[model samples]
Structure formats: structure tokens, C-alpha cells
Target: MSRRLVILRHARAEHGFAGPDHDRSLTESGRAQALEAGRRLALAGLVPDHVICSTATRTRQTLDGVLAELPARPSVEFEESAYAADLDTAFALINAADPDVGTLLLVGHNPTMADLASAFIDDPGLVSFPPASLAVVDLEVEWLYAAPGTGDGRILDGEGQVGKGEG
Candidate 1:
């Protein structure tokens, strides 16, 4: 069955947090970007069936803002592994997804998201997943079989600085 993967990089975050990197929260602009990204997803009719998000504060906040704009809430899992996930870890999570989930949203930090996006498509240079950016990829393979360069898919659409006026 065909699957759709929507990869989102956490929005702009506060840089000087006294705590750990996972504790950093989204800035005002990041919050706005998350809200805008959510609205764009809703408007585009790309509500996900499942969302696998990082446990980091910024990513959680991003998910919250995005969820606020979605018409229907999907099944969500906040995983600690996604906090600083590499490409392989990200793919492992994707591969473990339920087969019934036709559309999946993975929200985390970069450059893993960027790497994963590049892997799904034919050309790595075709996209750049900046902060708060979303990449929509249409995969020809099932979630269990998804892998780098194996999934026959292309970037259906993308939005950079989504909620911000910049893009």
C-alpha cells in the first residue's frame, strides 16, 4: 500500500536555555511557525493518520501548535529517540509503524529530517528542510519496507518558513 510521510523540523527555538538541549522551548516566532505549518497542513488536506514526535520540548510544542490547527487528532507517540535521531533511527521508527496508517507525520530535529527527506526522493539537492519546514513525500512502498533510496516516491510539496511571512 502507498504511504505518505510528512517530515517536519521543529520550529525556531530559544538558543540560550540554561538546561539541557532537550529542554529548550520554541521561541515566539517558532510558535507562530508551528501554527502556520498546522494550518497549511489542514488547508492542504494532509492531516496525518499517525504522528511520531520527539520528546524534546521544542518538538512537543511544535506538535501541540500543529495539532491545534488539525481538524482531527491522530494517534501520537512522543519518543525520546527522536530527540536527536539520525537517519537510521528515523527509518526504524517509520518501519515500525502500523500498516493501517496511510499518512504519517514525523516531527523532530535536523539534519536527520533533511537526510531522511533526501533519501525518500531521487535528488538530495531538490529540497532543504529548514526550521519549521515541512516535506511531504509520497511513498510507493509500505511503511515496513521503507528505506533510503528504496521507496519510490517524490516530494509532493514543501513549505519553508511555513507560518512565518518569510516563505
Candidate 2:
């Protein structure tokens, strides 16, 4: 069975302008971006059955912003290991996702989020996910076995768009 996954990088954050990255909270625009992105996902019928987010403050805050706008709240889980986590660690976490969930959303930090999306969707060069950007990919396989460039997944087009007063 195919598994649908949406990966979102945390929105722009403002933590006194200088501090720990993990502790950074979303700026006003970031919050707005998250809301807009969530609306886009809901409009596209991409609301996840289960939501997973990195344990970083920014990531969780991003999830919170999006979840706040959802009609039917899905189960949300957090994994600290995904904060600044590499691609390998990401795959392990993804593989461990519940098989019963047909759709899973992962909110995380970048380099890994971007890399993983590229790995699964085969469009690294074309699609670069900025902060608060969301990519919806459908993999024609089980979740656990999904690896970089290994599964049959394609990027759902027109998912990324610039926001008003985007940061």
C-alpha cells in the first residue's frame, strides 16, 4: 500500500535575533506562514492521519500553529532525535511510524527535511523547500522500507507557494 507523507520545515523564527536555534520561536510571519501552509494542505486534502514533529521548539511551535487550524485534529508525536538530525536518523524514525496510518506528516528542521524530501520525491534540484515550506509526497510502498531514492514516490505538484509578507 502506498503511504503519503508531508514534510514541513519549521517557519521563520525570532528568538531575540541571537540565541540557540533549537529554542527559537516562530515570528509573527512565521506563525502566519504556518497557518497559510496548513490551509493550503487542508484545501488540497492533505491533512495527515498522524503528525510527527522534531522536538525542537521551532518545529513543535510550527506544528502547533498548523494544528490549531485543523478541523479534525490528528495524533501528534514528537521525536527529539530529529532536531538537527541527519538523513539516516530521519529514515529510522520514519520507518518506525505506525503502519496503520496511511498518511503521516513530519515537521522538522532543515538539511535533513530537504534532503529526505529530495530522496523520496526525485526532485532535489527543482524543489527547494524554504522555511515553512511543505512538500507532499506519495510513496507507492510501505513506510519502513522507504529510503533515499529507493521508493516510488512523486512530489504532488503546486504544493509550494510564496506567502504574503513572507519572511
For 1-167, candidate 1 gives per-residue lDDT tens digits of: 66888888899999989999989999999999899889878877889999999999999999999999999999999998999789989999999999999999999998898788777656535556678877777777888888876654444334422221121
Where is model 2 more than 4 Å wrong at Cα?
A: 15-18, 150-167
Pairs that collide, model 2: none
Top-scoring candidate (lDDT): 1
* Tens-place lDDT digits, model 2, residues 69-143: 777799988888888789889888888999998889988987888777777654435456688877666676688
Candidate 1 clashing pairs, residues 3+ apart or interchain: none
Cα deviation of 63 in candidate 2 (Å)? 0.6
Candidate 2 lDDT at 123 equals 43
Which 10-residue span in candidate 1 carries the lowest summed lDDT?
A: 158-167
Scored by TM-score, the top model is 1
Residue-level error in angstroms, candidate 2, position 10: 0.6
